[model samples]
Target chain A: MKARVTVTLKSGVLDPQGQAIAGSLKSLGFANVGLVRQGKTFDLTLDETDPERARAAVADMCEKLLANTVIENYAIEITA
Target chain B: MKARVTVTLKSGVLDPQGQAIAGSLKSLGFANVGLVRQGKTFDLTLDETDPERARAAVADMCEKLLANTVIENYAIEITA
Candidate 1:
């Protein structure tokens, strides 16, 4: 199986990297650019004899180390 | 308009961060977890009086700053 995981800073968190990128965009004549929030993305290949168990396991993985629960939120999608 | 940009390491690029995460997952009983590749995700709000121009501009932004062409590939999606 294959899975995609996205982890993002929660609303109201300061995203310095995002801000810098947005500023750079504005300077580059991308006047249409507004706010930008940066996050992390991961794609994984897994042993998927059973998807349900894998999903739960991956979610646990996210909570444990993939994301900082106090300031970040994560989502996972599974595909074969 | 709202845009989601995903930037990923090109295939064959070494992804040390992803390898570390996968190792952590395995330690946490996510034995199903296999190879992992890590990337970046961005969510942006843009002034989209016209989407076509905005998309082109965002792509340029990606090419110029958000992603490194030598090792990364990016995809952008627009949502209003």
Candidate 2:
């Protein structure tokens, strides 16, 4: 099974990296750019054979070690 | 308008960060875990009022600044 996980900062958190990218874009003449928030993505190939178990385990993995739940949100997409 | 962009390393590229994470997971007793690849995500609120133009411009921004084309791939999701 394959899984894709995305972890993003919750709203109202200051994203210095995103802000720096936005500033660089503006300096490079990208007028259309505005606010930017940076996040993380994970692609994993699980050893699990059971689809339901794999999904649950991956979600647990995200919550436990992959994301900071207090200030971040995560979503998982699974493919078999 | 809001956009979410996901950037990932292409297959065959070495991801040391992901390997370290996976090693940590194994050490912490996550037996179901296997291969892990680390990537990046971006969330932005574009200044443009036009939705179509905003999408195009943001895609360009990813291509130009957010992702490394040689070994990375990106995807965008837009919400109004």
Candidate 3:
């Protein structure tokens, strides 16, 4: 199965990187840009064949290696 | 309107960061992990109301700021 893991900063957290990007966009003439939040995306091809197990494994990967749970949240999507 | 921009490296490009992550995962006992690729995700809220215009604007942003056309590809998804 193919799995996607997205790790994003939680609400109420300060994202300086995202703020910098937003500011750069505004200066570059992207006037309508607002509230930009930057995150990480990972695509993994797992040996697991079952969607349920693949999701679980990916979620475990997130908790252990992909995300900092104190400030970030992760979502996993599985595709056959 | 809300938009998501995901920027990923082209297949033939080298991704040292992803390779490092995959190696770490394997060391941490994630044996099933394979073919990992890392990408960036940006969530943006635009003042524009039309979805089509929002997507176009986001795509332009990708070309100018978010992605490197020489080695990366970007996908824009608009959600109302």
Cα RMSD (Å) per model?
A: 1.2, 1.5, 0.8
Q: Candidate 2: which docking quality band? A: medium
The fraction of correct interface contacts reproduced by each prediction comes to 0.93, 0.86, 0.93
lDDT against the true structure, each candidate: 0.89, 0.87, 0.93
| Error in Å for residue B53 of model 2 | 2.2
Q: Give the alpha carbon lDDT tens digit for every residue of A1-80 in model 3.
A: 89989899999999999999999999999999999999999999899988998888898899899999999999888999
lDDT (Cα, 0-100) at B20 in candidate 3? 95
lDDT of 2 by residue, A42-62 (tens): 888888778889889888887
lDDT of 2: 0.87
Top candidate on TM-score is: 3
DockQ of each: 0.87, 0.80, 0.92
Write candidate 3's Cα lDDT for B1-80 as tens digits. 89999999999899999999999999999999998999999999999999988988898899999999899999999998
- Candidate 1 yields a Cα-based lDDT of 0.89
Q: Write the per-residue lDDT of candidate 1 for residues A1-80, one digit (tens) a residue.
A: 88898999999999999999899888888887889999999898888867787788778878888899999999999886
**Candidate 1 local lDDT, residue B20:** 93
| Shift in Å, residue A27, candidate 1 | 1.7
- Candidate 1, fnat value? 0.93
Which of the predicted structures, 1 or 2, would earn the higher lDDT when compared with the native?
1
- Model 1 DockQ (Cα-based): 0.87
